[model samples]
Target: MTHPAVADLIARSNRLGADARNTNYAGGNTSAKATDTDPVTGQDVELLWVKGSGGDLGTLKEAGLAVLRLDRVRALTDVYPGVDREDEMVAAFDYCLHGKGGAAPSIDTAMHGLVDAPHVDHLHPDSGIALATAAEGEALTAECFGDRVVWVPWRRPGFQLGLDIAEIKEQHPQAIGCVLGGHGITAWGDTSEECENNSLEIIRTAEEFIAARTAGEHPFGPVRPGFAALPETERRARAAHLAPVIRGLASTDAPQVGHFTDADVVLDFTAREKLPALAELGTSCPDHFLRTKVKPMVVDLPADAPVEDVVTRLRELHETYRADYAAYYERHATADSPAMRGADPAIVLVPGVGMFSFGKNKQTARVAAEFYINAINVMRGAEAISTYAPIDESEKFRIEYWALEEAKLQRMPKPKALATRVGLVTGGASGIGKAIAERLAAEGACVVVADLNLDAAQEVADGLGGPDVAVAVRADVTDEDDVAALVDAAALAFGGVDLVVNNAGLSISKPLLETTTKDWDLQHDVMARGSFLVAREAARVMVAQDMGGNVVYISSKNSLFAGPNNLAYGSAKADQAHQVRLLAAELGANGIRVNGINPDAVVRGSGIFAGGWGAQRAATYGVPESELGAFYAQRTLLKKEVLPEHVAAAVVALTGPDLTQTTGLHIPVDSGVAAAFLR
Candidate 1:
């Protein structure tokens, strides 16, 4: 059985974490003290449950909370007399864990323990950080909460921080909370509800203050729009010229890089007239240092910059950002500090074009992007009234190099089999294409869901993994322009395309004598011509990237078999098969492999079956449609119905590390079809 107070605390923490506006990603911490009898000694013990490092509070579970013996943690007070206490304090935190092999308590555990309350909420709400990082932060705190809140100067979080918080609490017993300069704000109470309410009240107070200060002000004033206003065709053309170059320069030593264009608050913030000064004001909160560095690197690319010169200009800007970061680190890091890590920019601000976020992989890049968006809004509010005054350079360095964060970095899981790889799946709204998208994403591939139905594609992308792992793009295979933009969208969103699944198709069943030219061309246009356009565009990107890639086409067993009333479908599929082989021959020199899958009897949940074709085929066989799948399953040697997942599995096998040397072959995913077997 769980304690009522602890359960309520967990619920409250989740509520706060669920909103990015309140707590961006995993940047906040919460703690609760509960008394429980130890199962081993049958003695009552005070246990502190705090959000562990790297644990996301939004989806936090009981197991995710770290348990610490309060008395043991309290014993460390005043024990470290030397200047270097971060490493020793971390060791003490480890020794204080009540049970063996649980997650280490958050680095702020000592500070939480020092607060004189059963429930403590420390949050990095943008509103709170906005006010905390402002120039007149202390004066504003006094005005907003009066004597209810105490303002503490910025100290690198460790033993010294805990001691300072304890002294403030002792002196100001009537205050509901205290503000950590350049960090965030913390509120405490006797109950979980009280703690939550206090935090919200404080945030509301800060919001009201900013509102009064910047009554008619805007942070980033208006500026000219660049590629932002271009037509879809031109926008994609610009992205193709810019994204690959940025990815190449960002890669450093890695073979590939991940990137995504963020239109969400990018143009509104980055294109502003005050961007240069506004951007240099520093981070809203020091904790954001983990995801978004101290500040984003701002690159100026005029909207009219020639496509040919964009790459060279981008390269120079990247090097300049790296040099600035190195110098900043050298200026702040002390003699005892660990070796400075690589100075890669986490977020890049383009004045004319929208911002581009980068990471070792797409998911990480998206996380960084989320924080930057939050920062933009927060800083805008702060600058509206008071100039943005964030923590000093020394404080940012301390937080970035804190031992707790370093340990979390070391604990990150090794990349999955398909890490840093990107896959584009056409017709991804349902059936085989959807299955392929899900499978690839599960294996750690960033996916783009392309379909004729824009709404359906968006739904599928959202269900897969939101905009991070998968993005939706509307494309019509027969249109040359749509195909070109589709390829460019994937490349722009995830660095470069590594695997292209040309799986869009529709069947038109008609006898050769009855088939009209329209019917014949529709099937051929979708399967044969669509596959060709996608394959050609993907190969161009893969060749330009100088990295090996896979292009898999979904054909049909009808290509090899003679079937009644399947003239147009069968002929188009046959064309696709030959097209795949030709593509393989041409792209082989560029280290790109092209292959095909011939699937049969995949009736259940298939688009063709759902669109009235299954009943027609069943009526032709003199059986009910419900029995069509089973009847076909019984015809194969294995007596198993071909499933969409099975087809997806075959696609994975070909594109993964196992089939690097084999290409230009059509693998059958159907249970053996005697009529379709090669003669």
Candidate 2:
């Protein structure tokens, strides 16, 4: 049975972790003290439960709580002789575990053990950090919380820090919490509820103080939509021109595949009249160094800058930032420190264009972007109130190089199956295309969602990990220029496209005798020509990169087995299947594989079924439109209707390594269609 206090602590910690404003994805800690029966002593003893390091608080459970005997933890402060005890403390946290079921205790376990209250909570809320790391933070904290909060000077967190906290508690016996200057805040109470409330109260106080102090200032103005140097109509085009350069630079020396995330805020901030002065202010918090790094790399590129100029400037800026970072490390490292990590910048800010955040994979890049966004807000607030003051280079170095902090980075999970690959799916605004895009992203591939409906495509892209993993592009596949641009966009968005899914089509299910030339032309133009255009353009890029690629076409079972009124649709689909085979034959030597998926039914959520043809077919079958899906399911040998996800899975498989030796093939994704089976 779980201890009631530990259970409540997990629930409360989850609530706090769920909100990024209160704590970042895997940052912050919480603890509770409870009495448990000692197995050997047969007596009730004080037990402390603290959140383990690197465990996400939002999904925390009883098993995620590190439990330790209070006496064992308390003894460390007494026996420890000096301050350099990080390695010993880590070992002790694991050795002193009361039970074997939990994770390693957080590095701040000793500090939490010193708090007299039964429940203690530590949070790195942005609002609290904004005030805590300010130049006049000490005075501002005193003004806001008065005697309710005490101030702790910046100290390297470990044994000596815990001792200092214990001494502070003794001096201010009635204090509810204390602010760790240049760090975060800690709150304590007799119960979980009290501790949670105290922490929130401290945050609320900070929020109100910040608002009141900066009421008249407006730091983040709306980003102007167009570039200053380019004509209004060509503003976006110019920005697009720089995308590939930024994406290329980001991928250099990346251990895994790297990509870029774009935003208007980044461009707006970089275009400020005083870019150098504002950007050089350094990170907002010490922990932020892991994401935004010491500072962002700023490049000067006019709105109308040519691609060559943009590339040159970006390369120069990256080199300068790296050189500066190495110097910073040399000035700060001591004899005892580990060698400083890489000097590559995570964020690159381009004037007139937007900001680009880079990572070995999408998620890390997104997190870096999020941190800088918050940093912008906090920096603005600090400057408005007073001067924006954060820890000096020496302090940041200690925290960044700290063994305990470095361990958390080492514990991050390995990348996913398709970690650095990029996938592009046409007609991805809805139906099977959307499913394929989502699935590809889930497998760690950066996806490009191209559709005729630009707005719908953007919406889908925003939902699929935003601009980091997916980008929205409008392409009328039948138009040669549009098709060519779409392929280029995929390369610019995520460095290159390795998976191409040509799935865009319109259905016209009229019988041969009744189908007019107009209807027939539309179906063939979209299904046949569209597929050809996308494939040829995509193949050009793939051949240039010399990297093997996968191309899958979404054909239909109608192509092989004729239906009553599927003449136009089936004929066009048949053309697509043949094109896939030919493309595979021509491109095989270039390390490119092409395949097709033929699916039947799938009446739900598909555009073809939602249109008038499905209603006509349903009426002919003497059934309601909704019943068609069930009818198809029963008609199949497996008694299962093929879903869009089923087709999407096949696409993923074709692009995966399992089919490296196989190509020019057609996979059937329908439940089972005997008539369509290849003999």
Candidate 3:
């Protein structure tokens, strides 16, 4: 008889899968096993139940389950051959399973069988997954789990995976499970309930550890909304195209699929110009490979590309990917290593379109897709801790080509949007903020320049006239109410906000000895606290919109290097810079990008340099106001005063499509001022 708790286990696993789907783009996966003695054969047998392709677990049904003969799977490990024979092995296994009235086995069946337990389950829980993808992930894992768990370095999944796990099991027979490096976890138990409980326990433990170590960590900044809403027909078409691909990759049967029309996280993350570094680290779980490939296939269809051309382009992409895979393998393969598998991509992420995953059955595909989606969120979280450092390129190539890892690739539907998309900037009034806003608009974005100084913002906006346009708004970034209203206005004015330039700030240059408490409060309120308020509102809107976005802070070079006379200004800017780093980590998962721009000696109409040096004071420096510009220029390698336009260019570059994978970075626009100090 089926275990009484099997239903509950399935139900919970499905729910987790669904959560992943809603949160990220094809980001997570789930599986369960049943060990029992066959009544007819009177032999010990294990029935592995994994989620089918194309559907999430939250609403998964029986049709989503892919049943594998565990004993037969275990037998394959003993007679393993090189990677070239993986297809033959899979076909043989499929034939055997078919004879028994079972559907196709999960792509990860071999790895799952290696656990040597009655039931095993895996997932890329957001918190832990994020932690695993960081630069110091291994160290962090050790600090979190201590000796309770064994950390396995990243390895490709499939037959080789089976061998690796078999080896691991031999070394740590009592090990509750393993955390795949640059990936997620695998937990096993004597029963399905035990498996679920153990998975939960492991995740909870990891979460506590991360929270304690990185307290107050958040994403770098706010994301702007782009386009109020996508047409329903477009949304449905995208979903339908994605569903089949996910189902096929996971190797599941019939699967249930769902889509989020107004997902905040999706919009917020997508509106950004780039992906956070954490997302590049690796898949949330090694098992996720069976659904979403290690990396997504980025396609940016042009506006004029016909529908047929788009489809043809997708096919070309698939072909190109295969060729690339072969080349990568040829360049990196060692004599002793097995050849990589050539089929499938676990997940396919198409900007503007959506994401997709494939499986043998709906449940498995859905679970795998969800795992990919959750990884996006987790990667965002990790960005808050530090930039994610996945194994190096050579290592990624090794894993991607590993016969074990290659097994996870699957065919998927195309996503909307191109690999690169347009980005917009706000608060392009004047000063540092205005410069950044202008720079982004100068790039490919259709910029909406908003500021309290409508005329000033409009002037800059008018200068950037094109199909990719720039417009102005009279926004007061310091007012939360105004900030919220600004978001709405931008949504209505521009299709939506893709990039947010939180460059608006105010400062009173005064020594701490003479500064009033009110002055200090004002500094904080405008630069630090005001930035927080704007970011919060932006996040709320961006997350709901389902488009990735970018956020940048126009902090001062004073944030890092303090000049004696500017106490209130320096302190406030310092806080603003810190806040950007924190926000980058928190919002990365939502696919929102955040960063800071620290500029020095930016000469603009705002007049930070109005005090003409008296002839005596000028003689003290041995230079007149007329020569100050030349004097400062002579001090730098670039030999130019920091121009508002130059600083603006840097801001635009940071917020533009070129830097999509960077977040929480502090770029100095000081013409080598900080570098000079180091020298």
Q: Which candidate should be chosen as best, given lDDT against the real structure? A: 1
The per-model lDDT (C-alpha) reads 0.79, 0.78, 0.58
Count of backbone collisions in candidate 2: 0
When 1 and 3 are scored with TM-score, the better candidate is: 1
For candidate 3, lDDT tens digit of each residue in 1-679?
4444457556766655555422233333455556656768887666666554444456666665566666676677666677656645655456434125333455556666667776666666777666667777777777777765677777655567656765776688666776777767777777766776777777778776656655463453443233222454564344433332332222222211221222445434443444433333455454443345556554445323344555556667666656665676677778856656544454554444454544332234445545565656666666666556554556665554555334434444332222122233444666655566555544444566777778887887787663225567777767877776666554433323456666666656555687899988887887788788878876765564445567788787788775655688788898988888899999999888899887765544433443332232234456875566566567667777787777677666776557889999888777777442421
Instruction: Give the per-residue lDDT of model 2 (tens digit) for 1-679.
Output: 7779988999899999888777776667899998989888899999999988667788888777888888888877666757755557767766678867277877788888876779988787777777777889888889889999898888766766667777787789778888887778888888899999998898888878788877653554333343333343354454455554555455454433334444555555655554566678777566576677888888765666676777787779878877898998899887877777677777777666556676767667667777786676566656656667877777777788877666776777887767777788999988899889989999888999999999999999999879777899999998999997897687556656678998998886666689899998899999999999999888766664556688999998887987787788889999998998899899999889999999986787787678776787787577898889888788789999888899999998888767788899999888898999865
- Model 3: how far residue 480 lies from native, Å: 34
Q: Over the full model, what C-alpha lDDT does candidate 2 score relative to the true structure?
A: 0.78
Clashes of each: 0, 0, 112
Candidate 1's error at 628, in angstroms? 6.2
The TM-score obtained by model 1 is 0.85
Q: Which residue pairs come into collision in candidate 2?
A: none
Q: How far is candidate 3 from the true structure (C-alpha RMSD, Å)?
A: 24.3
Report the C-alpha displacement of residue 280, candidate 2, in angstroms.
2.8
